[model samples]
Target: MEHRHLGHSGLMISEVTYGNWLTHGELVDGDRATACVRAALDAGITTFDTADVYAQGAAEELLGTALAGERRSALVIASKVCLPTGSGPNDRGLSRKHIVESCEASLRRLRTDYLDLYQAHRFDETTPLEETLIAFDDLVRQGKVLYLGVSEWTAPQIDAALTLVKDLGLRSRIVSNQPQYNMLWRVIEPEIVPLCLREGIGQLAFQPLAQGVLSGKYRPGQEPPAGSRATAGGRAPTFIGRVLGTPLLERVQDLVPLAADHGMSAAQLAIAWVLAQPGVSSVVAGATRPEQVTENAAAAGRPLDEAARKKVDEVLGDLVDRDPAKTAQMMAVKPAWRTA
Candidate 1:
């Protein structure tokens, strides 16, 4: 697989990374999860991304076991902070206490001493940015984390943090921002991409296939395929179901012929499209089966050329969601002010 430098950092990462979001302990058990990870290793995927909140932290344990016995230097493992892991006032956020404690927990779960990339799952607006930045700098100083990153942060949030790092003389700077990017989800294009590019922060995009909608598996009028993410129920209904409508599905269907012309699967076509975007360092793909692992890994070296990318845009047209406002999480409401 081809590798590229992650932003301005010297560390090189695979163009296509293996990410375990909903698959590890939720959908598959130990043996099955290990097989998929082994498949990724066989396909030459050196980078793996996960979060401490995934499956109540079981995902990290599973990934740790799956990556056992390999040379740790050959891997780039990333985990996130800032998400509430428990129902305590001090159990979450990017506060110094939470960041330090979460890093320790993640290190134990990943069965590693240091993580190549430590990411904040989201912007913790309640906490002072200095608190989070200082904590991350301490981790780097302590040799617990090699690099820093953030996920789903707005352009202003990222810029503010980067400016703080520079002005405060912090040792580690943010290198990447993880966001949802796909044919249908273009929310990061207008502002986030440009600012990140200007700041030399690469993008490690998740949901590159729009949660499998761009795979052409969901027909325009037909019910979602049994056992697919669209039909997986639970939170899947809210997250993946939005892209399963008739118009979007019909537009996605146009990618099938394009993938056929290139001798690639519809999923690969979707991934290839995301990699063609500027500042996208890696496309974090999820897979349940070994063949799925192999299929996505092949997209690493093969990028969608200019013509193919244009064709996809032409077919998608106004159906893409490019509103910068869409990046805000509805659930992230600030607490009400209390008079002393």
Candidate 2:
């Protein structure tokens, strides 16, 4: 597996990180989760991404069990905070109390003493930026979290945090941003990429296949294939619904042959497209099956060349979402976690 530095930091992570978002505790059983993780390790994936909010923390526990006997020092274990994990008023957000407590809980769940990277699941509009930065700095000082990151944060929010970190001389600053970036979803390209590049923050892009839409499995007018996330009854993620449109699906079909021409699966082509973009440190791909993990891991270090990328752009012509405003807009629409 190819490795890349997380931003300008010395820490290197596998270019393809195995992440468990909706699959672990929520969608699949423990045995299946373990099998997928084993596939990732076998494929040379050294990075694992999970969150405190995924399946109300069961995901972290499952990941911990799966990697129990592995050499901890060789793995880049990452998790996130700032999401509602309980009903209590103090159970969520990036407040100092929540951050500290959450870090401790995550360590226990992951069966680790320190996190390779701890990230804000999302920007906390309710908490003071200084308080949040200070809390992260405290974790760094206490040796609980080695590096810091944020997910889905706007360019302005990141800039403000970095400025505060510098002015306050905090020990920890953001090294990465986790955002949904793929061929179909390019919202982070215009603003976040430029800003992060300038500030020395790399992007650990998630949903590199647009939740399987770019895999060419969902036909333009046909029902979503059986057993797919799109067919997961009511358990499907809301984000998957956005890419199932006829126009998008039809355009996705055009790229299937393009992928074959390059000796890649549609999924691999999609992942390679994201890696080709600037400021991307890794692509976090989740899977329910072992072969899925194996397929995704192969996408690393095999980026699309200039002509191949241009052909992809022509095939996807005007179907991509590049609006930087969508970042803040998405944050606004996300349900606010209860503070009371």
Candidate 3:
């Protein structure tokens, strides 16, 4: 229910954003997806995030249907571009051609004429940064996208974009970043966080539960729970590799009593941990059920105190991924996004 400003901008977003990455119109039924979105709204979540590449665009359509009749002025809707939507070379990247076309398509799919925030899904090294920035500026000037953001971009990439915008006298600049951040994944901590803080960009974190690994449902030695993401067939399983071992599971188990002590679930604890980090504007949590949505929304605005955070650090000693080089990969672009 608590809202935070997206970076230094005037726009505000709910602390816990409802995101349908692999759930809506993909892993779950349409009814379930709608119910989860309703649950998020009932819990006072006004921010909804989806990507064009999620479920091949079905996710955006499902989210649009779910939020249909809600007050658009009272909500903050966000979507992303720069992903391969088809086989054509123009189907992806942050090029001017793709960005403009993708924004129009996203608006149609989201059932909204203007996006509260439009983000680059990932950096496109092949495309000239000027082309992408100009395209984003064009959208901003046309009143299609209110704010700009980038996901999975490194510190240098962000800095370079900001510098270019300043040098070229462009109006559009990055306000937020969407990165995979959670209890087990601290890859953005060392370099990206400092740079973003300095650059006035806030973190709209994704996978705050470590793709359900921190949900405490995945036992160390036991088989992944039936129908769980780890057991399901999709790209969600791909990111679950980092935390599937017994060592991490055992540490998670140790945190259970800690969660009980705090009167929260393991999932809530995971969410709280991410929100406590500096520069985090919101934690985008995914849900398959209505109850899960409500449960996660409760983690908003309530972060652990210094003592509790220190205890968590001791429990997860040396397990965090802090390497700056691991911030991004070439999944979206052939050779990674940062050209500098």
Q: How many backbone clashes does candidate 2 have?
A: 0
Query: What is candidate 1's CA lDDT for residue 41?
Result: 94
The residue pairs in collision within model 1 are none
Regions of model 1 farther than 4 Å from truth: 330-340
Question: Across residues 223-321, which tens digit of lDDT does each residue of candidate 3 receive?
Answer: 988988887767767656545777777888888888878889999998988888999999999988899999999988776988888888898887766
List model 2 lDDT by residue over 60-140, tens digit each.
Answer: 999999999999999999999999999999999999999999999999999999999999999999999999999899999
Assess candidate 1 and give its lDDT. Answer: 0.86
Worst 10 residues of 2 by lDDT: 331-340
Give the TM-score comparing model 3 with the true structure, all chains together: 0.95
Candidates' C-alpha lDDT: 0.86, 0.89, 0.87
Candidate 1's residue-wise lDDT over 105-149, tens digit each? 989999999999999998997999998999999999999999999
lDDT of 2: 0.89
Question: Which run of 10 residues does model 3 get worst, by summed lDDT?
Answer: 330-339
Q: What is the lDDT for 45 in model 2?
A: 99
